[model samples]
Target: MTEPESEGMVAQESLRHTYLQAIGVQSWLPRGALPHAAPSAPWVETFTWPPTQRFEQWEDAFEDTSEVPAAEQPVLPVTPSVNAPRGVSRALESLQGMFAPEGTPSQKVLESTPPALSETTPSASALDMSYQPEPVAPLQNPLAERYPEPQFSLVLMTLGELLIVDSLPPQGRQSFSPAHIRFVSALARSLGVQGYDINPIHHHWPAFVGSALNQGPDEALRSVRRLLGNMLKSQEIKRVLLLGEASAQWILEQPEPLDSLRGLRFSLRAGVAAVSSHSVTALLRIPELKAELWADLQPLLATRT
Candidate 1:
């Protein structure tokens, strides 16, 4: 090999050993210096094992007990006896002398003492013979009391952009009667709405009969609003016609009288216009209400036609 190449190889080996030693790893090196290599520091051998004398010194440290005094030694605990200690016995004797009659002995005083509670069992005579449990009232259903069975039902119909909401009779049939349908058909014709554009949506509160779900007025309002909001998304309804007091109460959450709410246009969520009027059932029963309903619808009719 060339002299320069051999020197470079030696230098690389030395650098590797230096790196290993710096990181705390013991690396083996040639005993004799490599040819053409620079003079390196002498390697010193280190021994970790202690000398024999050091082991002898450690043995002496553990074996030598002469420095510790006998008074500081630990003693085993003695088991307690049934009889009282000497000091306690003397104290009891003095107490008995002061309390008992002049001639009475400690034996007599101990004999007159009551039996230990642990040794005595309760007798039948010890318990009260006439113990009676207090009467417990029957449990009443809180859900039934808090929210009485909800009696609300409604039908929502849409014609083009005009939405109609009417409440059904709570006691009788649920769907719209023939007379009611005829009235709605006539109303649709007046607004120039075709029969194909008419769509009806039924909404009932509490959803499930005899369920524990909350069917209060507040829940009814929330349910109706959600129903209407979904209906509005499906169609582009610009106006809402609320028929009957129940319809206004459920949809608008208005507690005012039906007469007061009639003939006035209100704004619903999403900027839809709403008008209140008497229901078809009311119109059929009292023909006089038909004129009042027509007056309320004038504004809506003007916008439709």
Candidate 2:
């Protein structure tokens, strides 16, 4: 470059540096360094700046002093004397005499005298006061231990009835169809039972027998009978009406025709009796079977009064 241009550039850089220093910004490089070749700025360490006059006064007030102030000195605890005062000394001596193993009066008397004989027999009242075995806690309810107790007695329906009932819309109605309920209610009334109240305890034939559904009818029926036994223990079921031939045949443990079994008395669980009859659903399909059902209920009616 030409001499004039180089001198002009040098003068401009000097002017910029002077301006920055005037505004309290320190020079970032050596004083005479050209602006184009300026070195990097070095980092400075930071420090916590201390407070001024007020804090200085606080420090003076908090400074420790060695001189003892003019006030009462703390009292040193007095050690007790080896010789106690008259009254306390006398009381101590009496306590020592009473508790001494060899010197005690009770000990001396016991050593000098023979042991007295114990009574030959304890009194009856003393015997009564002796420990007696605690009563055994009542056995846990057998039904609760086995399964959740179904609340209702005598569920009256065929095994396949659940299939039809479950298919229907489950809202604005009882679990069973209206017609079936009406027929059962009528049958219950005819038998002289008050309020045909029963919960639809199972849905689908499989639920009635649980996992036994895969094992054939006899196994399923056995499971159902076991379930009924639990119900008898848990609920106050007087009579379970085994509607439908499948239920009756299994529960009664007899394959006899409905004609022979309908009117006959059949024992079920220990305290419960089961009466066999045609289901109301079957009667709805074949109105003729209802006559036989009515006849079957006669024995149940006789005991109602």
Candidate 3:
């Protein structure tokens, strides 16, 4: 995309996330399977338990009664100096030290400060004490560890190649049409990782191919080079699964004299393996991949007829 278009998307994303944060909603709402809007009249549903069945104790009643004022929260006078294990006493002493004001205490002042003690069993008052809810543990990064950051990080990997058989002259290809994605899904399924194929097809190959189409050869080549460099440098990826022979050739950029990717001068990075596979038709004929993944990935790559 153009700089302006990219910037606009970033700005929109920022606004959406910021709004969600302000409203104290879960970030997953945007990423999750749940609907984004309120339920319709027919879909809306609600029910409540009887109060006795709902609450088991007085504290529960107190919590349920929002009518109680925060200022009216009575501070219970807890008895002190009950005998406790040395560990418990020491822990309480440490806690008191942390919460209490600074400086050595005079004997008189120490005497006034309640002894460090907790009942062998917690007192009703201690059990009833409530704390204000802390802010949600800083929202965990949604994408961390799930996807490679868009930076260039190289890794040793098993790489596969895919080549798309182009359509007839009447129908020229542009971006990743159905064939490319189907091949990717097919490859992934050839392994046993059982998630929808929609993911990598959107993020991985497109990162390279999309660059080429929008900005022309040099720019596209640069993106692919960087992606490869990063993949090796960062160790972010492991296996390299090439989808179709045509896609494999496109990346290899054989301008002419290449009928099939089988003859392409592709090099596997040291320590990384590359598995070049036949298309869906070739594999669909067989019930199983040489292994399960070939079978699995092939189906994921296949487009619904």
Candidate 4:
């Protein structure tokens, strides 16, 4: 061959290899190279099928034959050859692995994710409402019913006992006991002054004294005396009766015996006459004390006149 013709053939060969490489063929054979051996027949599909055959023909084709007895038929164990092409073996292995029992890593992760707790568990309200406690009612005091405000008076009498309705004064009487009631009524008539009952320990009195005198019930004389003093002087009251030992000693600031103090006239800071007397409750308990009371009252009543 001439030099130019040889060069043209070399260029064509180079172009062919380049084209093969671009098409993803890793290797190529020379144009006149011998052909590769044909691939082995598929073991599973070696027989040809007649597409137009009836069902009966297919049954006849698959039917067992005694001429070729089961004992005479040879069985071959099919396995891939170790000497098989690497690509062919790899492809076969991947195809076999497609039907494996275990799932893919991604599939396993999806299964491992826990179900929502709300879906599996019961709600708190659904479990029970009994656990939530009922609201409690507040407490109330019967202070008004227990103690009522007294009618206005200059000569206010503080009593120790709380007279319930069952122990109330009888008809035509001002106190629970008839004798003491008569005595008090007579004294009021003689003195020309009105009398009203009060209690130092009365439920309402503490609040009254607190607001009026800025003193607590514990400072008995100071609070009660201040309150009474203000009332007496403000209302131009001339006299007050301190009944019973508690009333007299507390309001008068006098710790003298009741016997010594009874019916005695002591002047208050407000210039009101404070007459110490035996309580009606005590007079009822000991009727004989009335004589002593009458004796004591004569001097005090005489001064009033």
Candidate 5:
């Protein structure tokens, strides 16, 4: 063939390579087939089914692959040299990978990226929902420190943890006891103390102190005194009828005789009196104390209402 004829064949081959890429089949062509390959036009980029006009134009120039498809169909993926250009072949293979079936998972759709923003909608890049957090309400104080608080006439001592409930005359018992449970419930009912009659566990010292005292003596006393001081600040606190010598001893730090009438009252101040009883069992028997505590509590219930 003359020189013009040879150049024409080369140009035809390049066009055929371009066409393979247009159909997303760049990997099927020979290596280095298009030495100076340029980016194909936009029509070629999205083209899937080859247009009939272009197909006929390059029909004879296409590689003849009639014999290669049948026997080696399984190994065709392992040999990528049979594909087209490096970039185009990679892209087509990637597209094939997207649709490639997975083991028993083919029915499920593969993960995709989030949708991008367009001119008609606000850019997701400028999202400001972070500052639009829910507003939090302020903390409430039920004991509104309104009146002149009375001093606790006397304090009974006991060794236990303390926790708080609502405001009013405050008290605590030793660690949980069925007898203590029964005692506080009846006393709470009898005295009309502001609380539920359920098993009295958390609203007192024994339940709360151990956890606080676990830290150390400084922490324990600070915590215990802090609890007691809060009770002392109650406007209704005139005197604390210490239910047990154990509780009384906790306040005074010297275990006094439990049954002695002389040890019953500890003079905390001229007006304040800390009196130890045997237990709520004693209070049940003592008619005068039941009346005194009852009188001490009447105004508290009215204030709560």
Candidate 6:
């Protein structure tokens, strides 16, 4: 290397060593000086036994007490005067009144002063025993009276791993109409499921014969969830088809309109996929809903195929 390049490299190394030493790192150097590097300073030990300079004894340091004067008393802050701001003066007066004796002028003024009354407040003479408040209505049972007696019927049918939840007709009917039967059979066939493979399980709300037991929505929901949980445990159910609003409400605990919930998939408690659609009865009554139901069923059909 040329002379200037060699000098520049040595300077860079020296700068790096300086940085390392500054950060408390002990940098190693050649025992003999380098060709271009500056001579390093000789090392010296800073500490020595029996410290070189003498420290004065504790007794000797405290012995010269004659020159030190006694500590003066601390001064207290002066109290604010009456000429101060109204808020400051009032605060001071209140503090003074709090500590003042019973016979003081402040105490006397407080004793003579009358409490301020509101303009709307009635006089003592006007409030008589004859004036009576209206009797408060008895609190009704919020749970039982708040929600009407839940009356709904649903049929839970399983075909292979698919669970179909549909609302049954009113009047305690356990089975679906012929039209519903045909529709379900066709749907099953489309999904590559045989008619014989389909098993119907009836679920009726407010199962109790009498009104003695609590049969509110909460209780009904618990009952339905319990039944669904039991079914999920018993069968290898993977997907759920919720038909009608009642089936959706009780099974999914979702009371939204079927139109809003129809095409969307939901995750059930046991990781089962669920989809809600119009009831078979509704499809029969209003044929136009079939097209919407068909659109909704397309995703499930695609999965099945």
Clashes of each: 0, 0, 44, 0, 21, 0
Residues 1-305, model 4: lDDT tens digits? 56555544443443443344435566533333235955432321222222122222223222334487555543322234553334433433443343223333334334555777777688776786666677866423222232233211112433221110011122222334456555555556555554544322231233342345543334433455566655554555555666666556556655566777777777764445666667766667788987776775564455552
Write one digit per residue (lDDT tens) for candidate 3, span 103-195: 445333366677667658676776856778778554232222322222211111222322222211112223444554565455445453335
Error of 6 at 96 (Å): 85
* Cα lDDT of model 5 by residue, 122-157, tens digit: 777777767776786642322113211211112222
Please give the TM-score that candidate 5 achieves against the real structure.
Answer: 0.27
lDDT of 6 at 68: 42
| Angstrom error at residue 147, model 5 | 38
Which residue runs of candidate 4 sit more than 4 Å off their true CA positions?
1-183, 192-218
Q: What lDDT score is found at residue 207 in candidate 2?
A: 36
lDDT (CA) for every model shown? 0.64, 0.47, 0.37, 0.45, 0.40, 0.65
Give lDDT tens digits, candidate 6, residues 65-120.
Answer: 33544333222222444333334334434444443444445663476567888888
For candidate 2, write residues 112-185 as lDDT tens digits. 55666479767676676777899976533323322232211124332211110112121222356678667766
Query: Which ranges in model 2 have alpha carbons more than 4 Å from their true place?
Result: 1-175, 206-214
Q: What TM-score against the true fold does each predicted structure earn? A: 0.49, 0.39, 0.27, 0.34, 0.27, 0.49
Output the worst ten-in-a-row residue range by lDDT, candidate 6. Answer: 43-52
Clashing pairs in 1: none
lDDT of 1: 0.64
